[model samples]
Target: MPSLHEFATWEPLLRLLRTGNAGNLAVPGGHVAGQISHYGWSLPLQRRIPRPGQAAQVEDVQDEFDAVQRVQGALADIGADTISFTAEISPTGRSVLHLISPGPAVEPGIGGPHPGSLILVEDSVPEPWRRLPDPVPGAVPAPSVDLASLERTLRERVPGAVGATEAEIAATEARLGVALPDELKVLYRVTRARWEDWGEDHAVAERVFTAVGCELFPLDDLYIADASSRPCPWRFGAREAVVTPPDAAVQGLVGSPGWIAFGDNGGGDRIAVDLTPGPRGHTGQIIMLSHEDNIGAGLLADSLSQLVLEGRGPGRRGRHGDGPPAVARVNIRSLDSVRAAAHAGLEVLSLGVWEGAPFSLAPVTGLPRLRTLTAYPGTLADPMEIAELTVLEFLELGPEDWRVLVDAGAVPRGLSAAAIEVHGSRHPLQVVALANELLTLWDRPPITRTIVEGHLEPGV
Candidate 1:
């Protein structure tokens, strides 16, 4: 139970967050342990709680896998390019130690360019907003705001938004020929004039929801995908799909969803509303679509306000940091961060934006247990050290000596899979030979050889 002071500035990220415990489907441990969730809390960072004499309970690979997938689902709701979650339980609730990533989801193929915005209001801009146009002597301050109109606009017009002027908002509604739901005006003034704009003063009033047993959390954050960016691969089961570009067909797909894009999960998906309603949806009704859910572009939420209020529902409080730090991705230049992650028991490492400089696998060998490594081979001065890991199951890159890592006995005996890319090299036979050896080790079929015009026939 550490004090509030012990946390980073992201503290407001969890403020007023409701917490509780629920009995979930029992995990393999055969214990119906209490499930902890936060209705208004989420962050990304790996954290550890000091257990003076107790053994540290680390979650296994499956648990990490499940958690990551669940986070992926949530992120898509916000149209974000990344996600951050915490697990370390502190006095107030869960205290995270290492999670702080907003990167794309890790999959077989590359993640797309995350082109969206993420702004947390309450935390960044506290109540009594910065430019509170001073209160007048008699008339109620800004009571010109019409509640019923605002609420109606939130429910029927958009998924919910604010921080802009009435005139600006009107113009957008007029242009789109679709009036926005009232919830936005009721929350904060629209930020700008365009349909997707948020009023410059994005903060909400304090104690504004005292009437409700639980306060209403506004839809303060916004993330609209920019079509100019490229798309990423979205994997669901064995199939893969690419989301539509901004200017392509199906007006409600990725970059060009006719309605306002309010959410993204960093994976290739978004929750959007239609300004130009079509056969698939009506104006203001929400829908979600991505490369994976191409066929599921139907009505999602009724209005912007409902989406936020319902989406912000409360959950259990405490989370145990029993899972190992599964993925640690650091910039190649931040060797210190890499070293720090290894020291903290990171199991999977993804490093670099490599240059032609020499790099060594030395710093990572210090990790008592590292199972997977993803890095660029061009930077490695000595990838030969990879042969040393007893538990290495996957090597993301081909070694510097790819031509003979296996025949030379440099590939670790435990390494089962590696993406060996020898696109235009002189010796393709050596790579085929190594591939055959690794396949044999895994008890899988070997490569089917094809003959060169004047070389030995196929496998001959």
Candidate 2:
């Protein structure tokens, strides 16, 4: 057996072995194997045992599949838009590089995202080996992520997050007038910094879950730095519905920032994310309503949040790179709470309030760092106060808030780009003023803008 001093990381010594290859090498106990090459790690068969001798063949196929899925799921969970892998095993004695392969990248939408590419070779090689696989039609190389290094980087860069003790967590729930899902709490206890390369997958995953009409909630709130030692709050929610089909209508919710609605087919009109008695509002965090529900104030909030997160401008995160400083283009329902939260220095704030609720914009003071704000088509509490946010870059206002913008005299400072859906507003003049000057509104046609405000000058 190798001495403890000889090893570095745990689960070391990975290697791979082909199913039909007779070049078996004897390995010590600490080694692991991996199979790289022609066999495309059949994932469907994993988790099922075969009949004795056949068990090795089927189990190998399945074991490889399990490995691929395990890693793939992790990748997707973290938002790696794509990944793939091949299979192999470790040697018996050595612990490092025993069974491994060059995991490859797999693009989603093509027979699903492939797991990372890997190779299971014999345990004899002391030096790390890299062997290329023959080109398989559907096979793609997986993108590499130094997860450990990344974790270390996060630890180094971000300040440590203090977690809520059991009692404190309970007190927060009592004070907030809502009960948080355990999964979300877990996520909060961990960390919320968005992982590199995983944003797309996370977005896609949210879309998939939302498409099924399940209630979706942003999990960004629960992410904290003190999370390494504790269970992830988001995981608590995930555990409840892990067995639920990925496409099922009752998926667990995610509470991250940047809520996006991908494609058009919402699985009918099922409710996604349930915020019920939470801080956001009654619609249960961020949710997508049926077409009828879309007009609801909460629907507007969800839409606005989605819009602001998508547009190209100063505030949005933008595409992977060089696409533009994409602003979050949103179709919102209200701005009341967002206004307050903004003053709280919160860069990312959740929007929740079913559409059709009364509009009010309570002033949010002191949140100088607030960068983004979203709301649905509800009324405003104090519209004029919005101009005070000199640093505000992205502003998604509910329909009623347009009046407040027009009344404010000038376009809100620092708002170079924005997105909003002005539906069923009581004042057409306010809407016209918005379409004419401030926003690059999309849902309504520009021609309509001329007819409504053509009589009046661009301002009022």
Predicted candidate 2 versus true structure: per-residue lDDT over 66-171, tens digit per residue: 5444444444454443322222223323222221111211111122112111111111110101111112233221122223443343334333523345675566
Model 1, poorest ten-residue lDDT window? 122-131
lDDT of 1 at 251: 32
Over 4 Å off in model 1, which ranges?
1-305, 308-341, 351-357, 366-369, 399-404, 408-410, 423-430, 451-460
**How well is each residue in 138-220 modelled by candidate 1, as lDDT tens digits?**
32212233456545543343434334567756765665455555544444463222223433222322122221112232333
At residue 319, what lDDT does model 2 achieve? Answer: 19
Using all chains and alpha carbons, the TM-scores for the candidates as numbered come to 0.31, 0.23
Q: For candidate 1, report its TM-score.
A: 0.31
**TM-score attained by model 2:** 0.23
Compare the candidates by lDDT and give the number of the best one: 1
